[model samples]
Target: MGRNTRKRRMPLATKIVAGAAALTVGGGGLVWANFYASAHEDHSGHNRTRSAAAQVATIDCPDVGQKIRDVPDRARGEVDGELATMDSQITNAYQRLATTRRAQAGDAQFVQNSILGPLKDRRKAIIDRIQLEINRAGGKADDNLDELAACQGRPADQMQNGDGQNGDGQMDDGQNQGGDGGDGNGVAGPVADDFVDINDVQPNTRDSRNGLAADGDGGSTGTFTTDCGVNENNLFNSDNLIAAPGVDNGAHHTHDYVGNQDNDAFSSDEDLANADTSCQNQGDKSTYYWPVLRLQDGTQEFDANDQGGGAEGNIGKILKPAEAQIRFVGSRQGDVVAMPKFLRIITGDAKSFTNGDANANTSWSCSGFEDRQVTDKYPLCPDGSQVLRTVNFQSCWDGQNIDSANHRDHMAFVQEDGSCANGFQAVPQLQIRLAYDIPTPTVENGQVQNPYAVDSFPEQLHKPITDHNDFINVMDEDLMNEVVDCINRGEDCQ
Candidate 1:
């Protein structure tokens, strides 16, 4: 249960072969008994089969959080609580989907009828409450909010894998595994096809260093580094203060936390400001956190039976990072301004699996192969090259609010030419570079061994594309000014 403490156990990957079954519509439901393939090794060593029978991989629901905007300040708390409830509902439904393979195989419509249908009804009630809260507070909720309540079961093969394409040429929807969720793999996701050999990936035209940044004639080139121990105290939580401030287990996944020590679902700005700092410099009390990475080797973690861990399909041994490098860089366009105290920013989309990759901001590569970063797949680093996860936060601030209704409108990414959009100002950008010493997974006979994945919402199926980062600025005024000044002066500082 402690740091680096894992019970050594190799989980066996048992192969399940599909048997003959009929696919038909019976009594207002579709039945495809015994046709769904079980988890097995294929000739190509990829975790998928070319069988014509369709298999339910994961559930896809409209992201209610992203669609609900213009929430009044007075109703924000209630809206956020209901949204967190929605996340929990999705997690529960996914857990059922993962454990009910026999039912899913016996009846193709079991997932839609027993899981997704009830889920939509619950979500409709939640959305109605959200609308009522907003309307009660003098804000108009969207008329189409009910449309977001229904969810559908997507076939495993239709999901985007490392290749970023599926059979129908639909954009990646994160899933790439076959069969019902879990598919006897123990963990729910990150099958062999989800990973790609780093050597096979073509070099991306966009430089890995500034994937989110742009070229500019005049820009601040300086950098500021902050030494924050990589969760040395093992601070972990399943809550996201920015997204679901008052809801416990808000994230539905474990997160490795470093920096302000008092962060939780109930922590307020004052609590965070007064909290102890994990950073080497006491002046910087900002909290940085992201989903914990886990190895699918059958080692149960401290939260193995807990709601956000094994119970939510995020089972495995948690991997502590070898290095956590937190740095602040200047805007690519010009001198940067100091970030406001208590600013909350979330980069990347945690629900990108079903919501699409429009806000997906993942960067995975090996330490030596940093030049070739891939967003859709986890990199299988060669020996001695540690796995790396780099994240770049948005640097364009709207100049007024530290937070927004959806927690995004107040900040934006820089444009192609490195300039902020009209009315937005350049601010120091935060970049997190995390390195892990994980064993390279093997794909022998289509069976993935020792696979690793980031913890994600249960329905997200532990896809690498769902990797995201969270931040809350609690730096003191003077220290923040120093950071801005150092970047503006084109001088590196610690």
Candidate 2:
């Protein structure tokens, strides 16, 4: 009976169809809701992801930019620091060299006093060593800086290449490729080369004749002679010889006159005794000698007696001869003689003479004489007394020709009568000449060749001993400026 009620029911097929339709509607609704929900949620998550990625990219960009910007500054700082260090090292080397030079100068003084022999070789060695050290320091600094620069990004050709297909093609892996080049780890090159060689230096010496004078007593007359060759003998010999009692005899014997009666009256027995004693001691040796003459009333006269022999015993011998004669003699031993106060004179070779040339043969007219006289050619001495005596032609010309020439080259002396004594205090002067080989590019056999050639004197410097103290000040300023520059540039000074 229930069945009959559902029955008014349509056909079984219709009921089934209605159920199916309802189920289809329900499933479609569920699918639509789920899709809508999912779409909204997906949008939020995507937005967050995009924002995070953007933030990361922005952060990375600034870091990279800052690093790039800092590279140069850091490099500059390092360069400056290296430069400062190099400067200090160079300055120290210079100081050491200067100190050594000063010490050598002191040694020279000792040698002058006969306390030591010449230290020419030692001084030269010291100077050479200092030069070597300076060179080494400069070279090392250059090499180190060169290597640093190469590491920093020099030689652009050495950079690596990434594939074009990749998005990261332009990116660098931050690896250095270049090796040490010329510039130090971004540091500047070494300081300039400035030094003087010792071989070019010159020293001063003197000769005198006043030391050979005889004792001022009528009892005996001492005499000695030098054979400085015919030219020198004629230049210094006297025309008239004087003799007095015992003094005249001694004077005659000293003058090397075997026979002459005019001046023998003034000869003295003491002079003859002294002369004989000198001859006996020398085993009766006889030699030719040149007499030193004095000018009185425009007449040449011999005062001290000198023998014609080059015997060493003749140097301080007293003679009392009863005769006087004028004779010319030639003896090589007389070329160089030394007495208590006098020294023999000889003509030096024109080419060999470091002091004078052949143009002025009268350079030795005065013995042991020092005077300063002003001439149109040479300047007056510093004391304005007489013309300064210069050995070299250039020295004689001095300010007139070479205004830059050293004043010390022309010596100042005190003139007592015709004798010279007491030399003026001299100031130390140094001249430095620098020469080196320069490489040049040339084409040989159709090929480019770099070859070195000796360059002309490239530089010259003059320094006074007093300037040594200023080096410290110069070095300090240099160091401070370098450090300040590095700091301001934001360079890596280390």
Candidate 3:
């Protein structure tokens, strides 16, 4: 049989629809009306550049270990202080109670003393609570001491064998051996010649982005930018766009639904012009009317009116200002771009501008700024009919948007009375970047490692201290050193 040769082509309409569908499915379409461009334009007006200076330095593993060991001890100290305070308060209460009882016995018409009987009972209860807490603290402290002992034992075992090599290869036996402690595991093994000496205790050699070793000359710059908009024209699809006040066009509707016969009824500019003509012809006879148009991008546009002078048909009573915002996601490089001071919005005499209605003359015309962008010269719209100019915007420390599928990056509108900060007329895209000099982990010695190390001993033992009041708490520093010593000596420190 002859080979079949056929080329399948989709209709133009189908192709267009498919293209749009693809974009939306991939999160790359104008599903909403927003635009975001790199705010930090280089000299060529293109890409923005961010530079950071990181220092490369060694972090003494032993120091980290020590910090961890100190945590439990600190918590225990706090518990002790609290118990002492409680004791003092109880003593004072008892003294007052004794004096008040004597006075009451002598005087026939004695009033209730403010700081005597009732206070004494309350203080007694507090003292009881303190005692319980102290017991718990003591217990936790004991547990910590036990754990420390176990860790110490591991290294003692390795030291006994004279095998100075640690598990992580960063420390050796001689470096870890101290005092009378034997091999960490309480067992002896063959010692190796590679054992490090005690005097060699030093910082672990590792590269950290924020460390001084990473920052060569420290002459770096960065920039940052924030953009705010409305009508789906910014990076974020702001939630400020209000739903149409009347009935749903299709499946979505409620009791207050007001039917629009022409809903989704127009598909071209000419159709809208025709609708406008019909409005003019009906004149006063028309209770409600709308001229619909299709933009070049295929989105529907509508201009509506209610000539009935009734409450339901008033266009001026329904609209509000819409907004969208874009924020830098990560930290910038050299010459950092500071947060923006202004957010701009468009305003006009139309019933709805950028998906919001100018419902009230006063409401739509008021002008102000939010956050740190407040200033004396409040910019207003050109005609003074509405406030549309840029105003100062505030910077938020934790304002970076994290993509959690909840659309949290979207901006919300702040009402005049400050009632609902989350109330929004639109949503915007949020982006963030880590600031310069911030440390991030990278690969080292063929293994992934944390560039910013934190003390872990306190966190690990926190629950025990919280639960057992009578425990002797271990210090973070002590625990950290013990771990380092164990690792260096190839000991079985738990």
Q: Specify the highest-lDDT model's number.
A: 1
* Runs of candidate 1 exceeding 4 Å displacement: 1-55, 158-185, 204-211, 214-217
Give the number of colliding residue pairs in candidate 3.
118
TM-score of each: 0.84, 0.13, 0.15
Report how far off residue 460 is in candidate 2 (Å).
Answer: 24
lDDT (Cα, 0-100) at 256 in candidate 2: 23
- How would you encode candidate 3's per-residue C-alpha lDDT over 173-229 as one tens digit per residue? 222321111212101111121121112322342111110110112212111132211
For model 2, the run of ten residues with the poorest summed lDDT:
463-472
User: For residues 343-417, could you state the per-residue lDDT of candidate 1 as single tens digits?
Assistant: 999999999878888888898999878778888788998999999999888999999889888998888998877
Sliding window of 10 residues with minimal summed lDDT for model 1: 13-22
TM-score for candidate 1, residues paired by index = 0.84
As a whole number from 0 to 100, the lDDT of residue 467 in candidate 1 is: 92
**Which residue pairs does candidate 1 place in steric collision?**
45-446
- Native-structure RMSD, model 1: 9.1
Tell me the alpha-carbon RMSD of every candidate.
9.1, 46.3, 36.3
| Candidate 2 lDDT by residue in tens digits, 1-494 | 00001112122322332233223121111000010111112333243222111110000000110111112322322322222222222222221221122232234232222211122222233334333343444422122222211101011111111110112112111121111211101001000111111112222312311111111222112222211122211222111121111111111112222211111222222332233211111221112222211110111113111111110001111222111111111111111111111111121111111112322221111111232111111111122122112221110111121111111222222123212234322111101111111222232332222211110000000001001000000112332333334333333231
